[model samples]
Target: MHVVIVGAGEVGRAIAANLESSHDVVVIDQDGDIVDELTYSLDVLAIEGDGTEIATLQEAGVEEAGLVIACTDDDETNVVVCGAAKTKSDVFTIARVRRRTLLETWEGSQGAFGVDFMVCTDLLTAQTIFRISGLPSAQDVDMFAGGLVRMAEFEITSESPVAGLSVQEADRYDSLTFAGIFRDDEMVVAKGDSVMQAGDRVVVIGSPDSVSGFGDDIVTRTSNGLEEVVIVGASEIGFQAAREFEEHGYRPRLIEQDHDRAREVAEALPNTIVMESDATDTEFLAREHVDEADIVIAALDGDEKNLLVSLLAKRLGVDRTVAIIENLEYAELFETVGIDVAVNPREETAEEIVRFTRADYTEKVAMLEHDRAEVIEIEIGEDSALQGGTIAEATADLPEGVVIGAISRGGDLVTPRGTTVIEPGDHVVVFVDANVLDEVIEAI
Candidate 1:
C-alpha cells in the first residue's frame, strides 16, 4: 500500500513510523530540517513542502497512493488537504480536525467533503480520559471499535475480596477474559485456573456493562482505592488527564511552574487543586503531599521534566506513575526507570488517523512502544486455519507469543477455552507481541 501523509510534526512522524513497515509511505512537511531528520530515522519518502498545495500532493503520488492522511495541526489545513486529495483521485482520505462542531454535525452522515475518516484528537483524548475517570477504580480503559468493546486494567490490592479466587470462580457475574496479569516486572498471559493474588495488576476485557460491574466491586472492597491524583505540568494533555481523573471521582492536584497558567487550569477544573510549583523540585513535591497521592501523571512538555517527575513520584511511593512522552526515542528508558506506563499522545493520535484512512476491511492496528511490535485484529477468512477447530488445536500451529483473547461470532463473544471451537467467519482478537506478528499472521 502506498500512503501519502501531510504534516510532518509529531503526529505525522508517528504515522510514518507505524505504516512504513507494511506500506510505502511518503511524508510532506514545510520544514526542510524536519524532512531530513524523518528521512534518516524512518524508511519513508520525505518531501519538504506545503501539504495543502496540489503540487506537493502530486509530487508525493497522492493520486496513486492507497490513502492520503491530512494530519496537520490546523483543522482547516487538514480538511483542505483531505478535500484536495479526494478531488484528485478515489483514494481513501482521512482528515484530522479538532473542532467539536465538525464531529457533532458529522454524527448524521459523512459530509459532502468525501473525507473517509476524521480524527478529533482532543475529542478522542477527552473521551478516553472521561471513560477512564468514570470508573473511579479502573487503572486504564482500552476501547475497541469505538466503544463496542472495552478492556480495563485494575490492581488486585492486598485487601481485595477477590484475592483468593481463581479467574473462573471470580467471573461468576458474566463472561470475562483475564487477558494478562502483571506482577513485579513480568506480564503473564492469564489462564482460567490462574489464581488471583494480592498486588497483581490484572487486565480484563469484556462487554462494557460487565466490565463496569467488576470495577465497581473492586473499588468498593480494595484499600488501594484512589482518592487523589497529582498531575505535573499544564499542557493540554495534562488538563485532559486532570479532567479524566476528576470525573473518575478522584481529586487531582495540578502542579504548574507558571502561576498565571496554573490559575487558568484551575478555572477550567473547578474541583481540582492547582498550585504553582516546579515539577523537578523535590522539596516542593514533598510539601504538596505528592507522596500520598494515589497516582502521579507527568505530562510536562519536556521529556527530562517528565522523566524527573516520574522518578520523583516513584521514589515517593506513588503506586502507579504514568508519563506522557512526546519523543519515541526515550520509550525504552521508561521501563528501566520504573515508570508504570508512558502515554504517547501523538502516537495514539497518529494510530487513530491511520485507522481512519485505511480501507474498511482493516479492523485494527496497534503499535507497541518505540519500534518493537504491533498488535492487530485481522478478520478470519472462510478457509483460514482458525476455523472449525478448538482453541488449543487451532493455536497449535500458531506461533508462540500470539495470545488469542476472544472470538466474536455473529453477535456472541466467547472467551476461548481449550474446548472452545472457532468456526468460519469468526472475528478473533489476538495480541501479538513485537517479535511474532509475522509468524502469527502466517498461522492465521
Candidate 2:
C-alpha cells in the first residue's frame, strides 16, 4: 500500500515512521529543511511542495496512494489538502484538526470535507485526560472491543504493594492480564516469573471492572478519592478538558489568566468554576485552597508555563499532575521533573491516525510508551493461525513478544489462558513489542 502524508510536522513524521516499514510512504511539506531532514531520518520519500496544490498531489502519486493524511498546523490547510487529494483520487483521506467544531461538522455530515476520517487533536487530548483521570494511578488508558476491553499502563512506585511482586504473584484481578512491563529503555514481555520492579511501567488488559480493581490495588487511594479537579489555563485543550470533567459529573475549577476568556468559559461551562487570575500567583492559589485538589492539570498555551504550573501544583501538595506538552521531546523531561503524566497532542493524534492503516482484521490499536509496544485488537478469521487451536499451541509458533491479553466473544469477556481455545470471530486483544508488531499482525 502507498501512503501519502502532508505537512512533515510531528504528527506527519510520526505516522510516516510507523508506516514506512510496511508501506510505501511519501511525505510532502512546504518547508525545505523539514523535508530534507525527513528524507534522511526516515525510510520514506520526502517531497518539498505545497500539499494543497494539485501539481504537488500528482507529484506525490496521490492517484496510486491508498491513504492520504493531512496534518498541517492550520485546520483550513489540512481540510484543503484532504479536499484536494479527493479531487485527484478515491483514496482514503484523513485530516487532523484542533477544533472540535470542525470535527462535529464533519461528523454531522460524513465526507463533508472529502475527508474519510477526521482526528480532532484538542478533543482527543481532552478525552485522554479524562480517561487518565478516571483511573487511580494510570499513566495511559485506552478502550478496545467496543469498550468491553480496556488497556492501561501504570507506573510501579517503590511504595506500591505490587512493586516487587512477580507477575504471577501480582495477578490477583479476576479478568486482568499483565501484558508487558517497560523498564528503563527495555521492553519486557510479561511472564509468570517476570518480576515487576519499582519504576517499571506495567501494561494490563482486561474488563473495565478488573482494570479498575487492579488500579485501586496498585495505588493507595485517599478517603475522598479523585474528586477535586483543578485545571489551569483557558486554552482550547484546557477548556475542553474542563468541559469533559463537568459532563462526567464533576464540577471542576478552571483558572484562566485573561478576564475575557475566563468569562467566556464561565458562561459556557455551567458546572465548572472559572477564575480570572494568573495560575502562577502562589498567593492566589493558597487563598483558593488549590493545595487540597486531588489532581492538577496544566494546559497553558506555552510549554514553559504548563511546566511551571505543574511544578507549582506538585509543590502545593496535589496528588497528581498532568500537563499538556506541545513538544514531543519535552514529554520525558516533564515527567522526570515532577509531572505525573505528560500528554502530547501530536502523539495522540498520530496514534489515532495510524490505527486506520492497520490490517482489515485489526479493530483498534493503542501505542504504549511512545511506540515501544502496542496493544492491538484483532478479530480472528477462519483461516487465522489462532483459530481452532489452544492459545498455548498457537503461541508456540509465534514470537516471544506477543501476549494475548483478553478475548471478546459474543459480547462476553473471556480471560485468556494457555488452554483457552480461540474460535473464529473472536476479538482478541494482544500486547506485542513494537519490533514484532508486523510479524504478529501477519500471522494472526
Candidate 3:
C-alpha cells in the first residue's frame, strides 16, 4: 500500500515511521529543514511543498495513494489538506483536529469536508485521563473487543501487594493474563517464575471486572478513595476533562488564570467549580485547600508551567499528579522526577491514526510503552493457524513474545488456557511484542 502524509510534525512523523516498515510512505512538509531531516531519519520519501496545493499532491502521486493523512498542528490546515487530496483521488482521508466542536460536526455529517475519518486530540487525551483515573496506579488504560476486554499498564511500588510476588502467585484473578514486565530498559515476557520488582511496570489484559479487581487488590487504598479532583488550567484538554468528571457524577474544581476563559468554562460546566487564579500561587492553593485533593492534573499551555504546577501539587500532599507534556522527550523525565503519569497528546493521536493501517484481520489496536509492544483484537477465521486447535498446540508453530490474553465467543468471556480450544469466529485479543508483530499478524 502507498500512503501519503502531510505536515511532518511529531504526529505525522510517528504515523510515517509506523507505516514505512510495511508500506510505501511519503511525507510532505513546508519547512525545508524538517523535510531534509526526515529524509535521512526515516525510510519514507520526504517532499518539500504545500500539501494543500494541487500541484504538490500531483508531485507526491496522490492519485495512486491508498491513504492520505493530514496531521498538521493547525486544525484548518489539516482539514484543507484532506479536502484537497480528495480532489485528486478517491483515497481514504483522515484529519486530526484539536477542537471537539469540529469532531462533533464531522460526526454528524460523515464524509463532510472530504474526510473519511477524524480524530480529536483534546477529546482523546481527556478520555485517556478519565480512564486512567478510575484505576489505582494505572499508567495507561485502553479498551478493546467492544469493551469486553481491557488492557492496563501499572507500576509496582514498594507499597503494592504484588511488588515481590512471582507471576504464578499473582495469577489468582480469573480471565487475566500477565503479558509482559518492563524492568528499567529491558522488556521481560512474563512467565510462571518471573518475579515482579518494585519499580517494574506490568501490563495485563482480561475482562473488565477482573482487571478492576486486580487493580483494587494490588494498591493500598486510602480512607478516601480517589474522589476529590483538581484540574489546573482552562485549556481545551483541561476543560474537557472537568466535563468528563462532572458527567460521571463528580464535582471537580478547575483553576484558570484568565478571567474571561474561567467565566466561559464556569458557565459551560455548572457542576464544576471554576476559580480564576494562578495555579502557581502557593498562598492561593493553600487557602483553597488544594492540598487535600486526591488527584491534581496540570494542563497549562506550556510544558514548563505544567511541570512546575505538578511538582508543587506533589509537594502540597496531592496523592497523584498528571502532567500534559508536549515534548515527547520530557515524558520520561516528568515521571522519573515524581509525576505519576505524563500524557502526550501527539502520541495519543498518532496511535489512534495508526490503528486504521493494520491488516484487515485486526479489529482494534493499542500501542504500549511508545510502541515497544501492541495489544490487538482479531477475529479467528477458518484457515487461521489458531482455529480448530488448542492454544498450546497452535502456539508451538508461532514465535516467542506472543500471548493469548482473552477470548470472546458469542458475546461471552472465555478465559484462555493451554488446553483451551480456539474455534472459528472467536474474537481473540492477543499481546505481541513489536519485534514479532508482522509475523504474528500474518500467522493469526
Q: Candidate 2: where is the Cα deviation over 4 Å?
A: none
lDDT of 2: 0.93
**lDDT on C-alpha atoms for all candidate structures:** 0.73, 0.93, 0.92
> How many Å off is the CA of 174 in candidate 1?
10
Q: What is the per-residue lDDT of model 3 for residues 1-444, given as tens digits with 9 covering 90 to 100? A: 889999898999989988888889999999999999998999999999999999998899899999999999999999999999999899999999999999999999989999999999999899999999888888999998789999999999998889899999999997899999988888888888999999999999999888888888877766346789999999999999999999999999999999999999999999999999999999999999999998999999999999999999999988889999999999999998999999999999999999977756689999989989899999999989999889999988999999899999999889999999999999999989989998898999
Per-candidate clashes come to 2, 0, 0
Rank order by lDDT, top first?
A: 2, 3, 1
Highest lDDT model number: 2
Per-residue accuracy of model 2 over 1-444 as CA lDDT, tens digit each: 999999899999889989989999999999999988998899999999999999999999999999999999999999999999999899999999999999999999979999999999999999999999988879999999999999999999998999889999988888999999999999999999999998999999999999988888888777457889999998999999999999989999999999899999999999999999999999999999999999999999999999999999999888899999999999989988979999999999999998887856589999998898999999999889999989999999998899999999999999999999999999999999999888988999
Candidate 2 colliding pairs: none
* TM-scores, each model vs. reference: 0.72, 0.98, 0.97
Question: Judged by lDDT relative to the true structure, which candidate is superior, 1 or 2?
Answer: 2
Worst 10 residues of 1 by lDDT: 366-375
